[model samples]
Target: MEKSHLESALPIANERNKASSRHVRQKLAWALIPLTLTYLTFSKHSPHMSAFHRPAINYTAQCIQPSALFPKDTPELSKAFDFISTPTFVNASIERLSGAVKIKTETFDDLGEIGVDQRWDVFYAFHEYLEKTFPLVHEKLKVEKVNTHGLLYTWQGSDATLKPTTLMAHQDTVPVPAETIPAWDYPPWSGFYDGKYIWGRGSSDCKNQLIATLETVSLLLSANFSPRRTILLAYGFDEETFGYHGAGNLSALIHSRYGDDGLAVIVDEGASFEEAWGTVFAKPGAAEKGSTNVEITIRSPGGHSSIPRDHTSIGILSELIYLIESTQYPTRLYDENPYFTQLQCGAAYSPEFDPKLKTLLDRRLHSGSDETSTCMAKHDPLALEAAKKGPEIKYLLQTSQAVDIISGGAKVNALPERAQAIVNHRINVGETAQVVFDHLTRVAAHVATKHNLTLHAFDGIEEPSSLILTHNEVLDPAPVTPSSPHPQTPFSILAGTNRAIYGSEIITTPGIMTGNTDTRFFWDLTKHIFRFAPGYDDSEGKEGMGNIHTVNERVSVVNHVNAVKWFMLFLRNLDEADL
Candidate 1:
């Protein structure tokens, strides 16, 4: 799918949130290595548990430590903030972000291979821009460019025994549609600041995050703070697209160096805090649904339109599309889905959650037995129905299908020789790309049988008067990051940092990125991957991010500053930990 289509799907995706692979423990020990062998492999060929084989939900797990964990205050942290709080530093930070945004590092799905495509040249300019804007970063960090454009920066720690902490943000922005330019409040590339928000195409989706990490690192450098553990900053240039040229290559490099589970933790741009039922919830993406594009083509005899058959190739294609859409994937709420944890978190913590629903949720999640069957015997239907209340929640559980692109006849008088439509599917947790492919094959088979046409799918041959099904960009669902309830684990460290910065009122919970991110490539680097942007948003997708990927895309100055502070504190907290 194109980045624009992915962005258009965000309203449904961003509405909620992973399916995880291994259960995370508070501490890693040699004895546990054998147990985690399945998770450590990080390959689609590895054993994957279908939803049927998934273990029962242990509803009794703590969502977050009863109270937020706080890192001890240090002089370096105080000094870091002292500089960060200054009006001069704030202005400079804003300008640094604006300057980066003004570069127009837009990437599209159709971009050709690097070196051949002149468009890839823009990232070279972006690299130079980074050098000029943050000279301290360039001078101090060990910098290497992967596959020509992926940026990897390493801050060498005094000690190498501890795994490095990795932070990620993409450097590319979705291209602003030429037609949508008139709808934008400011030129998409202007990086306009109206004393409140930084406005641009990349402002909210990623540039805000990229600049904030730099600002944090630069400030840490100013404090002359030497880390006990190494720090890695990975910026991919093509996250807005399929990310093969960027993150895919970067991950291969990182994997070669770090081996499996080498990093202490990985933090990437994802969901920020969202408010619901008067209680604020900070959702960190711990899992992601898989995605693939299925293309269906129908071939038939072409003649004058006047002599067309009862149904033309285009008509057959339309029938297939309708059948796929009409037979929507079943919505199932398994205990293992990350969104289930979010629902449990709301029920456990939200003061204003629907009382009756809370009661039902409690009965479902906290049933006496650890087995899901016991709970499903009674409360499953009610809980599933409650979860379907909104599209945001619905898509989190359902494997989504949308017929995105279609094409057919070219001439008014001639019958079309071929018709094609691309159906996009975000595979639900506990499902594989094969599952979606099989579903498409079944649908096509039925349609072909009804129309007396030859059928072609994964195992079929193409012929005239045939219906063909093929897939591309097949991505199995990501391995779920192992989230922990203990205070000392990586998940808890992130939750603690959010509480330390945003305050104790916020309830941190595990969330799935309904839409995937660059972390999809870094699955082997760490089991503790966290997709969180530390900014506050009380009204979903509004306060922290303003219309991301569409017109008027912007990020608030307050959220930007807060993100800088959060990154600073998060590094300190991670550095002090024993994970």
Candidate 2:
């Protein structure tokens, strides 16, 4: 009886297993319909999605066609061509530059490092050299000294009704480190001229501009080129360390004299016209990146290293720095960024740009948030390739930072009670000092919270160690300059001069200054502050060789001559231009 019941149960179990398998197959068949629809939906939207969604680039005044960036080109005044002389005065100019470089008129970054007794005598002698070198300029232009080192010369215009223009340069050169003297091909202060070039500290970094301005002005005055508008030659003594002392004092004096927005334009030593691969890119640093030096110091209990805690002051500081350096500020595009505007102008002119690179740049720049991740993924591989190929171009696209200096661990036995890191930021054109501060605050807070650390101020307040402190107080973002094309605009006038000199071979456009200049103090004086120091950016788009602020600093004598010519032409054309 038991065997018969078992046989019946086995048959029933087999029937139930077959029913379960059929039901699962029916469910899978129904699921395929939605899966196919979902895949189709994703494929349709793939072109619009971003792996990390953000706003697309804004085409700014700087990015649009040349017509939009500036007004129509004005007729070139013939007077500028009168003095268009070849670099014939090369030897004499080189000699003059060498003399200027020979003077050890060095400016220190820390004001305290410069002593009252060490007050520069070379600067006074340099003043005497200028007086002796250019008799006509000395006799014609009224010269005023600001704080001893700063030099201001006003070539009074026949017409005072017009707003005056300023030609700017710095009088001082960066100090050569005592240890690096052996590395120089010659004494850094020798101002050694080997016929082809002048080797010294300031040959490229500025004294060249000072000498060139004088050379141009002297030639102009001698030729009876009386200016319709007054032209001032403003030279600062301290620009390398941020232009506060030299340019600050001079700016105050000028502001008091001229009032706000009084000048037609201010021309200073800045970014150069770079010739690379048959394309000449004019980098007139019309806009300078905002700068702020941030300092983050971590503090904790001091104890023997042998009896260390889970974390120490140095460890905490290191972790914070890692967070900042490893994770960079988000890359964003702004229409106002002059750097991208420059690229837009460059791309318009150059056939050399790779088709794919151009396409990616244009797509990314002109694209909107609605663009799909699939679209980005397809182009991103090439976009990233383009950036890697031209790192200089990449630098223009984003706000940059570097952890320049760090200090901690005074002794091997004692755990560090304090550690500090100095991070320098060169702000993108549209961003502000506040944005940088906010970034620092956010990063600091995260690190503090994670480690149970606390921040303390010098005054006495103590809390989490997330407090942000500036190495040198805080620097307000520098004012933005627009070099829109107009007969009266500096860039417009500059373009005429560039055409006169370089012809079609040279392309001039407004670009951003990666480093800050003395122009910071003179922003209120003019909206058109054009920074074009006559030099060449090399093949890789670096500003000349690594000679700037390094050993064996030098520039060609021919460049020095060309600089003088450019200055003369710009001044002559500017004189005749109607503001």
For lDDT, the strongest prediction is 1
Best by TM-score: 1
List candidate 1 segments past 4 Å from native.
1-61, 366-383, 537-541
Estimate, for each residue in 76-105, the C-alpha lDDT of model 2 and write its tens digit. 323433433434466567778898888887
For residues 1-579, could you state the per-residue lDDT of candidate 1 as single tens digits? 699999998876655421121222323556677777755443212223222333444443546444555556668768778777789988998898888889989998899989999998999888999999999999999999999999999999988889999999999999998999999889999999998888998898898999999988998898887898999999999998978889999889989988998999999999888878778888889888999998899998999999779889999899888899888776666666787777777766777777666545544543443233444443345446666579887888778999999999989989999999988999888678887988888888999999998887965567798898888678888887777755478888888888887788888888888888999889888889889888664433545656888898988877888889888888988888888
For model 2, the local distance difference test gives 0.72
TM-score of each: 0.86, 0.81
Off by over 4 Å in 2: 1-88, 113-115, 276-278, 364-386, 455-471, 535-546
Which pairs, if any, clash in model 1? 18-287, 18-512, 20-480
The RMSD of every model to the true structure, in order and in angstroms, is 18.9, 10.4
Query: Worst 10-residue stretch by lDDT in candidate 2?
Result: 65-74
